[model samples]
Target: MCNGQRTEPCNVFPKNQYIEVGSSTEVVCQTTCVRGRVFWTLDNSPIDESLSRTINSSHTVLTLRNFTHHSATLQCHSADTQQVLGGTTIRTYSKPSKISCMLESENQHGGVPEWVKCNWEHQIISPLKINYTLIYEMPLKPKTELCHSQETNCSNKSSSGPIYMFTNATFTVRAKTTAWETSSDPYEIDPYSMYKIIPPKVKVTVLPDRLSVKWSRSGTYRICHCEVKYSKVVSDGTPEVVLKKTLGANESIGSATIENVESCTNYKISVRCAIDKAPWSNWSQEQMVLTKLNKRHVRLRLWRKIAAPEESEMRKVHAMWKEIPSTCQDTFTYTIKTTPYKDDVPGVNYTDISCDNSTCDFDVSHHAHRISLKAFQKGILLAEDSVYVPATGKSLPQVTGIQASPLGDVILVSWKAPVQPVSGYMIDWTHNGHQYYWKESKYTNTTLSGLLDKKRYNITVTPLFEDKTGRGTQAIHICSRVGDPGNVTITVDPNDKSVFVSWDTKSQEECSGTVINYTVFYGTQTGPMLNVTVDGTRQGIHLKDLSPDTQYRVYVKATSLTGTNRSSERLFKTKRFDPRLLLALSVCGSIIIILVLSLGLFCAIKWKKFSEKPVPNPGLSSVALWTSPSHQKGKGSFQPFDNPSESLFDQIYTEATQKTSTSPLATSYNSNPAGGQTEEYTEAATVVAPEEQNEKPVGQRLCSPGESTALLSSEKGKHSPYRSQSSVESPTSMSNKLCKRVPVKQLEKSTPVTVYVTLDMFEQGQSR
Candidate 1:
């Protein structure tokens, strides 16, 4: 020990502790020291010679490696001071312990088709007790367990009796121990429950064309694999392997191909499923499948009969069938019947028949086939025919030739009979079907004549027999030939108030006798008879006179033994005066006279104006008339008279000057005013002026007074005949009256008056 240090008491324990032979125990040593060495000794002796104890941080540890049931002492002390801190002594005993575990059994037992075993064991000290509990479950029942405690009469006197029984399916065993009411460590037993696991239930389904199989398992089990087997049955009652297949777990349904199998064939199939970690299940129940038969089995059959008598005709038949076997039965049968038929029969020959189990037959020739037969089924009758004869006597007679000839009051007809020889031949002739007659023709050709003109006839040749008149064959209806009317010669005679018309007739062999009477039809236009005459054997006749300029159409018909023949029409035109021609000539003559009068009048007026103008002086007047020399002179002379009074006087004087100067008498007046008052003298002067002017030389000016008066009078007559005439007449009167009052010298010296006259005369005369 040292100062400022603390010491603690050490723990003392027996050196040896009693323990069961088959059990385990624990020993402990504890001590506290202060800065000192501590050690444990056995029986007051140091356990180890060298440093059995070592200084530690305020504590000490002791260890004993071995222990025995033999009594042994132990001491704890400080090594340096040699003082004992603790000591203990004990006696040791060993007893066999009961071994226990968490699990009641060590070995589990259960098996499918075999027995399984389970066992357990435990070890414990003599004073300790062991308890065991076993839990388990079965496939069809829930889990349950049993508990057994040593206190509950579980024996230690005898080795624990074997606790053997059928454990629950879900087995879980555990065991625990207690010594003198102290609990021991618990132990668990491995789960070792046994069970017979069923793999799964497999279901199988078979289809008409295929097979399907499925299966499932319980409790997290999966089908890992599967196998299928199928069989096909033969006609001999033996089954053969048709398909076999093994499939993995991933595959649930398996298929096998079997092609070209007979229709309606039956098959058997089975399937089994194997689960993961489990045996395979039993095969599922067998399933059967039948293949469908072919659907294209219905068809139609037909037959026909050929040779048959006229009274008994041909026949037709019909039948139908299917190819299936099940539909065909022994009870199926067929029959057919028919009606009477005459000529063309049905094209098909078979008759309808009753259908039974899969087979039928129809008779086509019994009477006539009426119904249609179907194989393996009842037949339906659609139609039938009855026995009848086709109409006979179809052959017709042939007509070879026909002819016509005229007879007395009759037409003779004949036709050639058939060369092939018919029963008989009938000949008939009709006139527009109104009159007809029949005759027998034995010859190859016949003739029919004496037919009227413009008449139609139908002739038919038919074969005839005793039984009945055979149908008309090769018949032809035709008009017979008509004899031409005789050529007629007509004569006409005109009288004072009447005319005579007659005609002659020609001989015709078709006539029955001589001409009986003559018929005369006359009108402006040829039409139906307006007048008829009956004359017996007379060739000439007379028709009274008709009005002149009239037209007449006459037709004569000659009566004969057969009929009357009409002659060609004779159209007569009468002679008479025509007023239209005279009227046309008169109109033409009047138009020509009017045209001639209009032309003559125009010429007269033109000549009158020409005669009034006095011929100018050939030299100066030619210049004045050809050029505009007078216009210049007149303009210059008028310019000096610009005053209004002078202008008026100038206009009047200029007009008077123009009139007096251009006149024929203008120059004559300059010759003698006394002579101008006489027509003869004026005429002579007018004639002499031009003769005197013509004598002057071409360039020399004529006498001015004569030239100026002639120019003025000529201009006045041309532009203003009224003014010129008034001026000329005024001068003539004044000259006649004032001859005595004026001096001859003044009258002679002053400008002489010139009379200008325009002579115009109209005359009416008929030329031709």
Candidate 2:
């Protein structure tokens, strides 16, 4: 060894070298000690011997052709041992090239200033991580790093100012790895050329004759050159013809008018603008517009029917036609000419018939067999047609097995071919013997469309030959074929055990079908389904024997020859009680309550009246009547008493009896002292003894029942209390006379007697 350290067996030159992609490079493996035989292997795989050349015994060279790998390890080894001695990693790289720079704005449209964005078109392939730096230089400025990134593209977001347009700048990308670094070729550009323009906003207005297009100004441009292109929107499977126009530079609101556009037509339009001479911007959003209707004449498809001659030799020719669908316009009239078959025959030539509403009727002579009709709007002919009628004769064979069915708003009619050969068939349908529609079909089946709903129609299919027509087979039809029955309604019956179920059809036309029938499905919400069938003509049915007070679900299904339709399900609850019985009980209860209240009011009023009436007193009957001995004396025969004091008592008794009836308090004597005659006497007053009368004042000369002696006393020196002592006769003498006539008795002191005297009586006695 040259030095103190031991030397390796073999060493590879260019250790860990980087090379360009798709390029060939040669590596030499040499021995340090002596001339040693060596071989080359790449990444643990043996290299081809042809690619490796041995110069002498010590050096071996390996050539890598088209090295596409990122990195590969090359090793030098002894030919005999096959062991690795020294290795060098060969890395392939690409020089970053074709760099492109642009000025980008943050906003979609032209609003914010621009930033420099540079991208590397050439990719560097290397195992080591490579750093990319975007460098830009202006005419007067030094090259500066715009951005440093590990990606292929980088933006100069950290720039202090905006990138001005029209400024010439040079951009380059420098790529570097740990071992080597390379810069891309510089790209020179003008910022103005790299700026992008936004699409303009477009608006379209539909007009009667033309379309008007307006667009907002192009991005940040004062004057813009715009182009307007439009194409008619066709629905008949035809290619659209696009029309375009180039306009000069226009101001902020750019507008263009496309003249001579078709009326009542839809068109798709777009607008694109370019700033001066720069590239054209993207097309604006597409717009659709419908032009207004123009006032134009519409050609009417004329059809007519010529009736047979009547008995009066006047044939009534009924004609009805409709306008061919086109742009809407004003009404028009028709000119009908009924020409005779021969020149010698009589006929009528109606120059003009004012049919304002598309129908005309007139009577013509029987000889007039040929008819010609022309429709005109304001003296301008729109459409014309002529027909020749053939006389009634043997008709052609009629079509057989004809069937008509309604499909929504259309009537489909099909029939078997006639026995005789025919060119085609003419299908005609009429509504209410007035409006008519007909079409020619080469097939056996045809659909009659554009018919009204809720109206009956008579359709006929007649076969047409070279010169004649076969007898037509007629069938009745209606439009708007019946779907599911409409709106099922239910009403509970008054009997509580039944419900009246009814439903409606979409129209009366749906009800005119011959094979229609209704099946009503009804049941409780959770019970098995029950059904009842009804005739198609009937709209309502009475369901009987239903459970009362139960909720039920119901629907009506209408079955026709075409299809079956069901109405929406409905819910109804049955009544719990009989309505008629409850109504009768309610009426009776109201009447009884009124009668009871009337009786109570009447009784209360009667009691109130009786309580307010004055009551008659029974204590003030006449005292003299009881004292009289003759019971036969009438009440009117009574005379005034002899003593004035007795008159006071009579007046007081009369006043008391006037206010109320008097009743006797005590019955003293009813003895027959006159021998076999009885008289009733009641004690009116108690007679006081002479000693007791003198002992007290006159007004105080009253005594209790036990202290009273008698009402009348006939003892000597006794004065009658009913009379004064100053009277001409002695009190005892008059009392004795009265006692002898009436046999008056003395009441014992133990007898209970009640004496009622007025204040006037006491005053009179005191005065005496």
- Candidate 1 displacement at residue 176 in angstroms: 99
Worst 10-residue stretch by lDDT in candidate 2? 650-659
Q: Which candidate has the highest TM-score of all? A: 2
Q: lDDT by residue for model 2 over 648-760, one digit each (tens)? A: 22111111111122234222322334533422222233333222222322211212211222332222243222332122223343332222122234434543333444222
Q: Please give the TM-score that candidate 2 achieves against the real structure.
A: 0.38
For candidate 1, the per-residue lDDT at 52 reads 36
Q: Write the per-residue lDDT of candidate 1 for residues 35-87, one digit (tens) a residue.
A: 35666676655666342333345444454444553545766666677666666
What is the TM-score of each predicted model, taking all chains together? 0.22, 0.38
Give the Cα error of residue 767 in candidate 1, in Å.
41
Q: Can you give the lDDT of residue 276 in candidate 2? A: 54
